[model samples]
Target: MPQDDKISPRKPRRAWPVAMAVVAVVAVVAGAVTWRGQADDGAPSPDHPRNRGTELVIAVGDVAGGEFDPLKGWGSRPAQIRLIHSSLLTVDKNIDFVGDLASDYSVSDDALTWSFTLRDNARWSNGEPVTAQDVIFTYDTLKKDGTRFDLTFLDRMEARDDSRVDFHLKEPRSTFVSQLSDIPILPAKHYGTDYSANPIGSGPYVVADYQVGQQLILEANPHWYGQRPQFTKLTFLVLGEDAALAAARAGTVDIAYAPPAFAGQRIDGMTLQSFETVDSRALTLPTLPAGGKGKIRTNDVSVGNDVTADPAIRKALNIGLDRDQIAQIVLQGHGRPAYSLVDGLPWFNDQVVFEDGRTEDAKRVLADAGWSDSDGDGTVEKDGRKAEFTLLYPSDDQLRSDLALAVAEQARALGITITTKGSTWDGIYLDGKANAVTWGGGRHHPHQIYEMYSSKVIDSGYNNMPQYTNTTVDGYLDQALSATTQDKANEFWKQAQWDGQTGFAGENGDTPIIWLLRLDHLYFVRDGLNLGDQPIQGHGHEWALFNTLVQWHWTS
Candidate 1:
C-alpha cells in the first residue's frame, strides 16, 4: 500500500473452500486426505488477515496471448481486461443483472428489442459526457468490422439520443442483458476504425502505455461517474513463473497469479492466499468427420475424429474418468468434479451426477456399441481397429496437459488407447481446425450453449472443439435463445442439458462431451485491499465485473 501512489487495495470477497490452504500443501505432501468444504458460509470476511493493500501486484499464471482488443483474441481473458474496460450491465452471484453505464433498462413486449437509459452525468476521460452514440458506435464497429470475439448479439444497434439506445435482436434472447454485459462502451469520438491500436474508453482505468507481450501500464480515469479508484498508477507486467516468482518472492511484486503447482511455496514476509475454483481442465473429443468429409467442418483429423459420434462411447469415457483422483492428484484439490458444461455458471444444475468412475459401465457401453477386445490384446478394437486417438492441449497449459494424460490412462484401462499432444492454441483452435483437447466456461447461461455448439462459431470453434453437430439439440438451443420469459427459458435450458445427456441426436444413452470438473475463479490480493461487491454468478471474470475495480479501496 503506497500513499503517494494513492492506490487503494480492493479485496474481492470471493468464496473459499475448506481445502483452500491445503491444496498446495497436499500436492507437496504427495499423500493427504482430500478435504471438502460447503459453499454456504464461505464469503470473504472483513476481519480476515489476508485482505489488505494499495498498489498490489497480482501474479497471473498466463499472460494474454494477444492485444487487449475485443476484436482480437485476448479480449476474453478476464485478468487482462481489468486494465482498461467496463461493461454496460453487471451480473450478481445470484445471476441478477445490475446497471453499470446505464441507469436502467427494459425489454420490449415481444422481447425482440431492449433499451438502455444511459447515465447522463457519466463522462469519459476526455471530459466528454457518455452518450447513447458511444453505445451505438461500439455495436456498429463490432458488427461491421469486429473480429469474432466482439460480435455477439451485435446484429443490430440503434441510438435515439444521448440518453437512450436500443438493441434490435435477430431473435427473442432471454439472456440478452447477460450477453450485453460482455460489451464495454468505447468513446465514440476517439474510438473509430483505428481504435484497436489507440483504444479509448469510459472505463475505470485508462491505458497509460502498452508494450506488446511485455507490459501495460494504466492510470485512474478521474471523470468516471461512479466511485473512483484509489490507485493513481497500475502496472501489468508480463513475465513467466521464473520471473513472476522472482518478483513476488523477492518482494518486487506484491501479488501474482502463480501456478497451482507453485501454490504452497512461501516467500519470506509474504502470505500465500488460496481459494477453491470452478475452473475445470477438460478436453474436447471431436465426434464429427475430418477433411470436410462429414457434418461440422472440413479439416484434417488433427482436431477430432469420427469416433466421438458414438454416444455410448462418450458416456463410457465420462463414467470411466476418476475426477476425484484428478482433483486430488493432478489439481491438488484446487478444482471440483464437473458433470455439466456450466461448471461455474448460475444455471448449473447440481442434480446430475457423472462421478462413479465405473470402468464396468464404460465396458458395458462399449460392448453394447459393438466395440470389443478381439485380438486378445487388452485394448478394445472395432473391426480390427483398436480405439486409439491423440488428445491435444495447449503446450503452455500444464494443468490441461496433465488432465488429458490422466484421462488417457483411464481410457487405456477400458481397452481404449488415447495419446496426448501439446500444441499452440492458434494452431489448435484458431486456423479453422479442431482439437481433441481444450477447456473453458463462464457464468452458467444459455449463451454457453449457443457459443459452444451454435453454427455461428463452427469456423473458429473456440469452445466447441468436438465438431459436434445435431439438429434436435440445435432446435432446443434455438428455443432457449428465443424464449420470451426467464421461466420458459429455464425450461429450455434444462431440456438442452437433457438432450445432451439423452444422446437424442444419435444414441439414447451416449453423449459426446463429458464434463470433468467445476471451478470457482480464485484471486489473491495484498492485505488491506477492499475488493468490493462481487457477483457470485459469472465468476466475476467476465467484462461484467471489471467495473468492480472502480469501487475497490485500501484501508489502513
Candidate 2:
C-alpha cells in the first residue's frame, strides 16, 4: 500500500455569518463597478493602467472547501493552499529542491542538525519581516497537533536569530530536506484556527476576493521577494469537468485541467499539454490470505493466500502479463508500461528487468511448483487446491476495470483462474479482505518504500496492505533511513528492490505487487498562453498544474 497524503473527500462547509455575507456582497458589487469602468472593447481604461493585460481565468475540476491550515487541511486542496502560502523550500520543473523562503541551508557533519538562513528581503504580504520565529511556530503547532507527517524523529527546532533557524533530528535522514517541500511556513501572529477564511502569506499572490463554490480572485503581492508575476490578477473559476470543457470551448477560460480521455479533442483555440507523472496504476497481490489461515505468523496474526505465497507463482504472474498491450489499450497510448512501483525515480533499480508475457516459461514455473491441469479442466490444481483468486477493482474506475479484464484473460491462458469483480474501495480495500486491488501513490522521498513494504506497518492499516514481511527488506530500509549521505542511502534503496540474489524480485523473496502503467496528467491551455515548462509530476493531487502560475503570460 502506498502512503498517500490525500485526505478523504469532504463536503464544502457553508456557515458564512451575516457580517461575512455582507462583506462578500460588497466585494461583488465593487467588482461589478470595476468591470463597468472597462472600455466597451474589453480593454483596460486609460485611468487604470494597472489592469492592462493583467487578468486570467482558470477552470479547475473542483473547489476546495475546508480551512487552509496545513496541519488540519487535507492534501486534496493543494492548489488553493499553495497559492496562499509559502513553503520553506520548493521543487522546480526538474524535481530538484530549491530555496523558497530560505536563501540557503547547511547540514552538520553528523547529518542530524540542519541550519537555514532566510533572505533579507523576504516579507509577508502585510509588509512584516518573515523571521525564523514564524517557521518555529508553524512546526511547533503542527507537531503538537500530531499531523500526518512522521515527525517523531525531530528533537527540537530553535531560532538562532531573526533570520536563522536550526532543526535537530534524533537520527540522520537523507531525504529530510525534500520533506520540507510539503510544509508551508505561516505568519506567526496572523495565523490561527480560522486563518483559512482570510489567509495572508508571503507568496507571489494574495487572495483579493473569494466566493464559496463560485470563484477565487488573486492579486499580485507587492511585498513578495521573488520575480514579479506577469499577470496582476487571476481568477479561479469553480467548475466540474463538463463545465470546464464547455468554458474552454466557449473561450471563457484561459486554462483548464482536461481529463486524459478528452485530451486529444479539438477545442477551438486551446492546445493540450501532456505531462509525465509518477502517478501509476498497479495491482497489489496479497502475500497473506484474506482470513487468518496460513503458516506465516507475525504479532500472533496468521497469514494465508497460499496461491500468491509461492515465490514461483508470483514471479510467473509478474512476467505473464502483456504490459505493453495494457498500456496501449487501457491507457490509450497516453502512458508507458511500468516494471517497478517507483519507475523513473532516482532510487529506482534500473538493473531489474521484466520480460514480456511468456506462456511457456509461466507453465514451466507452475509445473516445477507441482501445479498442473490434473482434471483436464484447463485449471491448474495442486494438493487438491485450485490455483485461483478473486481480483477486485473500484467500480467507478474504467481504467482499472479494463486492466483487470486484460490481466484475467492472460492469466487464464497459463491455467491460472483469476476472477475479476467490480467493487467499491471500502467494500474491498477498507474491509482488508481483498485478494488483490488496483493501487497507486505519489511521493518525493524514498521513504515511500518503507511505507508500503515495511513489516513495522503491516498491521497499522496505514500501509503494507499486502502484509509483506522480510527481515532482509526491513534491514535495508532501516539502514537507508539512517544513512548519512543520499548517495549511500540510494544504494540501499536499489538493493531493497533487487540485489541479484535477494530482493522483491529475488527467487526466494515475495513479489507482493505487480506494477502496470504510469498515468499522465493532461491539461488544455488557450492559444497564446505561455505556461512555461512543466516539471514531472508525482502521485499527489492535480494542483501541480499551477506550479508555474507566476510565469504564465498572454501573448494575444
Candidate 3:
C-alpha cells in the first residue's frame, strides 16, 4: 500500500538529501532550514515560474524511520531511497533495466551468471569511490537478511577488481535481473547497525539530519557522480494529510501530498499534480471451505470461505459491480477502474475486462449455479446456505474503508449479502482468513503477477491472500520466472491470467479476488516547478513521487 507505513516494505522507496538555499523560494520554512538565497529578498517574487529557488521544502506523509535503509527493503517501492543511494542496476519507467551505479551489464550463455561493469566516476557522498565490493556487500546483506526481493537462487558474488561485479546463480532464474532494480547499494566500510539513521551512499544527495516526528533535511552531495540537482537543499516535513494541506495553502512549502478528498481545492501558488499508480484496492476472498487446512509460507494457517469459494459467486462479483462508477465516486475521479492487478501493464490479459454494472448478468450466473433468492429475504442461497460474507478493511484507512463500503453496496444488489467492517490488520489476519479482506497489490514488475497468482508465493508475505491455487497458473508462473527473455516471460504471465481457455480471471475460470480500482497519487506543487514526465507510480506513493526528482526544475 504505500510503504507509507512499514506494513510490507510494500512500497518502501527512496529519497535523497539536498542543501539548497530556499529563503527566496517561500516565505517561511521550519527550523534549521534557513537559506541565503541566490536572489535578493526584494527581487520579483519567486512564486512565478522560472524562479529557480536554491532550496525546496515539501510536506509529505511517509518519511518514517528505517525507510531510508535499502537493505531493509526500502528501495522495493518507488521511493526516495534511490535518491541517496545507487543500485548496480536501475529500472526505467518503461520497465526496462538500465544502469545506475553500474554502466554496462550482461548475462552468461548458461544464464547461471550475471555480471556488471560499474561507472568509473561514481563516488559516495563521503568522498570515497564506490566500488564493486560495495555492490557485493549490499546484495550479500540483503540475501542474509531476507529482503523483499527474492535472492534464494544466488550462489555467490565475485568482484573483478574495483569496477565490476559478477553474480553467480544456483539456477537460471530470469527474475534475478528484476531484483537488481529493487535494492540500493551501500558502502561496505561504513555500513553498520545504525546505518539507517546515518546513511552514506552515492546518490545525488546526502542526509543532513532527521528529527523524528518533525522533518528530514538533506544537503547536496559534493561527491555525487550524477547530474547536479537544481535545488541544493531538500527538506521533508512530516505532517498529517490535513496539516500538510494547510501548510500548502499557506505557501510555506513547495509541495504537499494532496488528499483526493480535497483534490478540488485551489491554492494560489500551487497547482495539482495527478500521478496514475499501480496502487490498487481489491477484495481477496478465501477459495476454500471453512476451517480448511492450508499453509501460509511453510506455516499452517486456517484458510477458507464457503460462500466466497464458489466460482459462481466470484464470477458474479467480478462482472456484477460497476467498478468504473465506483472509481469515480470513491476516488474523486482520480483513479482508474482496475480489472486485473496489472491492467494496462504489458503482461496483463485485457480479456479479463468486462462491461461492469450488469447486475442482471451477475444474478443470471448465480441462478444458473443454483444460487437463488428462494427465500422471502433479499439475500440469495444455495442448498440452504446463505450467500453472505464480511468484507474487512484496516480501521484507520479511510480510502479502503470507503472502497469496502462502496463495493458492499453494489454486491448487495446482486442478492449477495456483503457486510462491511473496519478492523485492525492483526484482527483481519487473526479472524478474517476465511472472510474477504480488502487488499493492496500493485507494482511495476511482472513478478507482482507471480507473487499474486503464483502457487510459489500463495502463503508468502502479503501475496496470494486468498490462498488461490491453480496448476495451470502455477506452470505459467514457473515458465515466466525461467524464461531467458523478458518477452517470453511477459507472454506466460499474461497466459496465467487468461489463457483463452482456463486461468485465474473470473471471465475465463476462477476469480479469487474482485479486482477493484487503482489509486491516483495527487500532489500540490508550487507554481513554476516542472517535474517532467513522471512514471506511472506504483504501490508506494511516498517512494514513487520523485521518480524523476533530479529532472524537476523551475519553468519560465
RMSD of each: 9.8, 7.9, 6.6
What is the C-alpha local distance difference test score of each model?
A: 0.59, 0.71, 0.77
Stretches of candidate 2 exceeding 4 Å from the true structure: 1-55, 59-67, 73-81, 206-222, 232-247, 250-252, 292-313, 370-398, 416-429, 459-461, 505-509
Q: Model 1, range 160-241, lDDT digits (tens) per residue?
A: 8778998888778787765466666677778544555566666766666554444455677777677767766666655555
Better of 2 and 3 by lDDT: 3
**TM-score, ranked from best to worst:** 3, 1, 2
Query: What is the TM-score of candidate 1?
Result: 0.81
- Which wins on TM-score, candidate 2 or candidate 3? 3
By TM-score, the best candidate is 3
- Ten contiguous residues with the weakest lDDT in model 2: 1-10
Estimate the TM-score of every prediction. Answer: 0.81, 0.80, 0.86
TM-score for candidate 3, please give it: 0.86
In angstroms, the error of model 3 at 333 is 3.1
